[model samples]
Target chain A: MKRVLKLAALGACCLALCACANRPPAHALDRTCEMGGRHGATGVLEYQCVDGDGVIRERPQPIHRVISGGRNG
Target chain B: MIHRCPWPGEDPLYIAYHDTEWGVPERDSEALFAKLILDGFQAGLSWITILRKRENFLEAFDGFKPETLARYSEADIERLLGNAGIIRSRAKIEAAIGNAKAWLAMREGGQDFSDFLWDFVDGEPVQNRFASMKDVPAETQASQAMSKALKKEGFKFCGPVIVYAFMQATGMVNDHLVTCFRHDEVKALSRSS
Candidate 1:
């Protein structure tokens, strides 16, 4: 019984290491999108996930607009 | 309801500008020069303020002809300062005159003003499909380079931030929100250009 318990603990540790090794960094996940070209009547930008989080979501996402700094008067 | 950029709101003149002029590529060297001067004047005021007085500005500035403006005398400056129809900031007026001289110099040097400005964007408009105002950057690397180049060429009030806005309005870059009706239309115009 003691040997079995030790093996089980070792397996759990290995599993955790494997999981982490397979995961991409948080920032990498955020930056994984690819430009998918313009879409719809309004021609908004469409980004497709080429890997990780975006692939899992399975839907193209629209990113934020870059606001120019100035009064724009 | 037809969707448009939120910035234009419901003002008729603003809407008209947004629909017909804003983001449309202007390749004419003289027209581009005039717009740049107008944008410089827009530094501390709302665009509508200048837009409302555009006719007066055109009349007062002699159609923004660089040949004419480069020769503006002190009397002309004084006359412009006293004009109630246009923004009467002496500094801005002076900059316009100086810019005209700079423009003339560029032409004399055999550089096309429109080509000089468009070269920053590789002779085409940058089509950006930003989803909202928040995503639109106030300045970009291109604008920074353009600003530096302009200042080196003696143009004033052409800072990166101001240059970026000018880029958007002049269609060197298309900043209309993807949800705005003008976005695709402007993009199409860019292709045609």
Candidate 2:
């Protein structure tokens, strides 16, 4: 019974590590995410997470904006 | 190969950033604050690490608005540390919040952040024509002056080196190499009002 519990705990730890390795900063995963493409509608630049979990995960790139005076936030 | 400063390597994102944005003069107050905070977080880490996490920083910091960030509580700092996207340094995060408060105070003190910063360079981008990346300085007298002024204003995380990089990134000074296409292009941009 103790052996069973230890193995279960080890398995849980592995799962946690794996999830962490695959989490966020989506470019690290290098998966094919649709949102990572260029679409400069909002001032924030969004980087899409290409994980198996298809969702609205994006990294915002808010560097450029063509305001009246010049480039803006 | 197309000539560039070569510091950005061949990453598509880097190339795009170099071609489109770097060294472009920016007069926006919030944008300046965001870049300064990002540079502070870059201490002891490669800039690529920060670049990759830029989006995360923006989202977590309420787009880094001074008023919003100045109000961040301890609970917010804890939550930020747990976030997987941004650089998880407690000191850097705290410095960011502190800087935000400083920024707000400056604004309240009848200071136009844009005008105050631009005055460092006398309201014109300093045109540097270096022949190599090695020639580009890590920090200049102007950066040190800026750093001292910012520190006096009660801002945090702004040292000479970080402020120098911020200057380059914001086009307060154009550090692009003379051989690079962007050198002339970005220089021309500085003259456009």
Candidate 3:
């Protein structure tokens, strides 16, 4: 019984360590921009994410379209 | 290209944010305010902690409206202290309310924080072709200028490093990896802008 209890405790500790090891690193959450193409041209596109209630989330799904100096209509 | 969501092996909430919105540039003033407050709360805490409590932040902070949040009273602060949805740090919680008031004051002075901020990048986005994550930097001169200006304006929790993160998130700078699919896409967008 004593040996079985020790094995159980060891297993629990390993599981806890495994859980901690799987956490994401801080830098991974940093914000960034997604550029679609080249510079100084009308085709250049950029997109950022914001919460759903905000204007940044107004774009269509799958692909959020942004054209510089152009109306959304 | 593994294309794993930026915050790998985290809960689905974080994974979804990573894959969909982590680095996307945001320009709207209200959205910017929301992100700014959230990032401030994220200081010295794992992002997963912030992500877990995002809904609570939104609810407790009146959806992050500068005008609404600026009016939060001591009672509100006390209420938030006990809320499980946000980081309960007294300093950070206080900073969010203070920053909101500062933002409101900026608007009162005929300055839109969005316009003020986007102007730093010359009304356009900076496109960087980083080959890997390591190639990106945590702070830049532009961020330093922004941090300085924000501090002058009475905003808190906006240090140079955090300002750079803010800049990247709002499309003032694009740090996507050159080989990553999003890099060229954002670059193309900037040229057209």
Candidate 4:
């Protein structure tokens, strides 16, 4: 009886860990920055990736970066 | 003296707009549409110019109700052009009408305008902590995405820079300088919303 109870507790812990691993991170649902629109000559557009804990990490470049021409609005 | 963003300068009206309205998250769909159209007219000109003419623009554009402006005819265009109180550019006026139609189209498709726009930021105002105007950006990756999406949806004059300015004004992002008094106040507003 004691052994069965210990095994049951261990199974529950393993299931919890598996559930956590299966859940997607917040950043996965977050948008990746795109750059096909206008940007200033002096300013740089920073693309950041925020982790599940809301920690922002600097991303070097977006997946797409196109420079378009237009007057600054 | 209360430390504030230096861009407002010494102009009383600009100061008032900056203090009371700027960076306050606006959830109203109609109000957002009005500000976007106004910002479009603000292209190639100072925002203060548009700010001063805002009331006049509101009066002229029928409070920027998308339903009303979407149905404006050529005569209405002529009437708007003749009005000296607002920006007199035919292109801008025509774009405003087209934009109103686009706005309606979005609504007709069952998309909530505010939710569509807010989704870019994941339904919360981005809290940016810049210490000075020089540190602030003219455009961001999010604004770039927004500009592209708006253009695809038939919006005109909504380039990334314009979109960014509109975002700042509508509180999609809090770009207030850390030294400015309203920075924390605006951030609090974001949390409460």
Candidate 5:
């Protein structure tokens, strides 16, 4: 019974983490930024995304350096 | 991939609006009028606040019919104050009525409001293909011109920033990113229309 209860708790922890991870990330909110219409300039205008609620999470950036195939050193 | 505007989960209403109409161009006179007033109310508040209260606005403003709204009396204002469907500010509420009167006056002068509005861009929707969010702007020359014209015509609550947002919402411009799926679709519709 003790072992079974421990496994159940571990499963619940993983489920909670997965649920939290599945929520929309901050960069996903940037997808709504568009540049056409009356404003003739380019750039992301400040828009209230998600009704001003919810936390914005930053994604981890890649650390590896990539070399361009067409560029010469 | 399904292109969605950032800020989904703010609320179901906001999510629906972002997915369906945030950057979509609008053209109908009534729809334009509704958006104009709504954007003005959004001056210092989150759009989600406006969206959540849209039903109240619609009910209070007589379904956003400019002609009908133009006839609103002081009693109407009193009635709206007690209703919780829209922003309860006296100034903003009164501005909607004042703007409706101005809109009707413009119509009486043989000017189609849509045409008058579209004239800023010479009847063609401006198309933008920005790759990153940093490439968009808050105001533009076109919005400035439209703002000037509307103010000259006695309309209030229409600043350049508001006009620019109006233009985007009403299809006067296409500000979708190249990678966004709706960008090409909206562009094609603009070309065909």
Candidate 6:
């Protein structure tokens, strides 16, 4: 009886671990910092994206960076 | 010191908006339409951002004339997307134009936009005397009704929260806090009207 009970407990733990592993990743809130919206002086309509968490932070560096991909379109 | 709504703070432009235009009763058909569309554009964004860009928006959208915006096409969408002044969200831009068309249709139907909105409160402003901004709501019964009615008419981007902001801006409802000096002032204007 003790052996059977131990096996049942082990089975429950295995199922819990599998459920955690199969759980999907949390959906991250969108965060985008972009250009081409009245902030620049030149009328060229340039666009770029940067990391943001709901606060507007200016990216003053030159647009051509080594890792240029961002969430903003 | 004159007690004012702290939300506007010390920013001169915001102060001006709060003092001069925020809660004052606005009855003009096109003007009310303009404010509502502007409020619609304000979704998922701060009001100050829109306020700062108001001039550029006016210039780009031809002062937000409903007849003109009502006729916007894909070309106009591209033009707006190219402009670097407004919110620049394609969904928001399209909704604005769609709302303009809805507004024009409402006008053509011989129903005044102001009357349609103000009638929610039986042609009077429902005054609320909240003590602080924290007490103010993001949506209310009136706003839900407005949102439902607008959705029925195919107006877009007018959720209950957005409609509540519109009501506060257009004086269909007074949401100014009781401690704020503008609260009594706006309520007085509603009474006078």
Q: Candidate order by lDDT, highest to lowest?
A: 4, 1, 2, 6, 5, 3
Q: Per-residue alpha-carbon lDDT of model 3 for B1-193, expressed as tens digits?
A: 5454232354777556655565566778989988887766654444555667678778887899888888989898888877766667677778889999899899999999889898888878888877765567667888889889999999898877667767766668876666656666566667445
Tens digits of lDDT, candidate 6, A1-73: 9999999999999999898663333432244544432211101222333333343433323331311211121
State what share of the real interface contacts each candidate retains. Answer: 0.00, 0.00, 0.00, 0.06, 0.06, 0.00
DockQ (0 to 1) for model 2: 0.02
The digit string of per-residue lDDT tens for model 4 on A1-73 reads: 9999999999999999897774446556554433322222112333344555554554433221212101211
Query: Candidate 2 — what's its lDDT?
Result: 0.74
DockQ of each: 0.01, 0.02, 0.03, 0.03, 0.04, 0.03
Best by lDDT: 4
Better of 1 and 3 by DockQ: 3
Clashes of 2: 4
Candidate 1 lDDT for residue B31: 95
CA shift of B177, model 5, Å: 2.1
lDDT of 6 by residue, B142-180 (tens): 889999999888899787777777888887877777887
What is the Cα-based lDDT of residue B160 in candidate 4? 87
Query: What is the CAPRI rating of model 3's predicted complex?
Result: incorrect
lDDT for each residue of candidate 5 in B74-140, tens digit (9 for 90 to 100): 9988887767666666667788888898888888998888888988988888998877656665778
Question: What are the per-model numbers of colliding residue pairs?
Answer: 13, 4, 21, 0, 23, 1
Candidates 2 and 4, the one with greater lDDT: 4
lDDT of 4 by residue, B14-122 (tens): 8898899999999999999998998888665556767887889899999999999999999998898778788777788889999999999999999888999999999
Which candidate would rank higher by DockQ, 1 or 5? 5
Scanning candidate 5 chain B in windows of ten residues, the lowest lDDT window is B1-10
Across B1-193, the per-residue lDDT of candidate 2 in tens digits comes to 6788776777777677778888889999999888889878765444666677789889999999999999999999999888878877777889999999989898999997888888999988999888866577767899899999999998877877778878888899888888889888888887554
- Docking quality of model 1: it rates as incorrect
